[model samples]
Target: MWGVFSNFIACEIGFWIVIILGLFTRYVLKKNKLGLFFLALTPVIDLILLIITGVDLYRGATATTAHAIAAVYIGVSIVFGKSMIKWADERFRYYVTKEGPKPIKLYGIEYSKHYLKRWGKHVFSYLIGAGILAGVILLINDSSRTEALLRVLQIWTLALGIDLVISVSYFNWPRKKDD
Candidate 1:
């Protein structure tokens, strides 16, 4: 029983780590896909940890503690995450303005066009990710510890990838007002 509890503790560590690392990564790559994906994953991963830890995911102390921790993780990820990403984004603009070819700079459209292109990319990217996930799930027999590890890795990879795309792509275009 005590051993089972360790899983949750380890998961908590992973969640907090994601929050810290994701924020730091965003500081370097303004719209980094990896950072964004981890940010989005913190909560979901925590929830999964709770379930795997034999905690009654939505009942009693475990639920309360999980929610509290998740709230803190998400809050920090958002506030620090935004500040870092914004600073980095400014740097990116500076870099691109100076280093990227002039033609590319001139070709850069306001975010709307970028968003349109992203939708198509996500469709294919997610399909591939999902396929990989399914293959892993099927290949691993659920009767062993390896299954859990594979599940964790697969979900993290796909979730993080998705978060990365969603997170950074939003920055690609300034939001337009609805007519």
Candidate 2:
């Protein structure tokens, strides 16, 4: 379990390092091909995490919260990774290189709409994570081994519910732009 958690942290740190390096290479060094090569490594990081987690489970390790989180992380990364890179690219171009327009600051209805879109992505991520977790539980076919993963699903479901409420509330009370 601890090994899985450690690997999860390492994967997250590695993902960002690759992203920043990619952006830097693209904008600062002006090497488009190398930058793209770096950016393309993001999926490889996800694959590494998935393989590590799967291997641990296959070795007869009990499914843990860390294992469950690894699944969720992979799902979220797959769904949001492109947008995340784009968002970072825009900011890196604007702030680091002063090459692009300033990133827009969302507020009011736009903010609500953006929040809703992200929440929808969260829904999709949850479905994918839960499906993987369920498949694992069934494959293992041992309630005792998968109890922690089940708890993770229950907790994540509650978190998703809370997120939905907040997302909808943004529409009712749109945020005001800063003075």
lDDT of 1 by residue, 1-179 (tens): 24444555676677667765665566455556887787677657645653553333222222233322333333333334444444444554456435322333212345545554545554444454344334434544343423443444455457557765764666674465455
lDDT of 2 at 89: 99
lDDT of 2 by residue, 45-72 (tens): 9999999999999999999999999989
User: How far off is residue 63 in model 2, in Å?
Assistant: 1.1
Clash number for each model: 3, 0
User: How does each model score on lDDT?
Assistant: 0.48, 0.95
**Cα misplacement distance, residue 133 of candidate 1 (Å):** 31
TM-score for each predicted model, relative to the true structure: 0.30, 0.97
Model 1: residues >4 Å from true position, as ranges? 55-179
Clashes of 2: 0
Candidate 2 weakest ten by summed lDDT: 70-79
- Leading candidate by lDDT: 2
Cα displacement (Å) at residue 18, model 2: 0.7
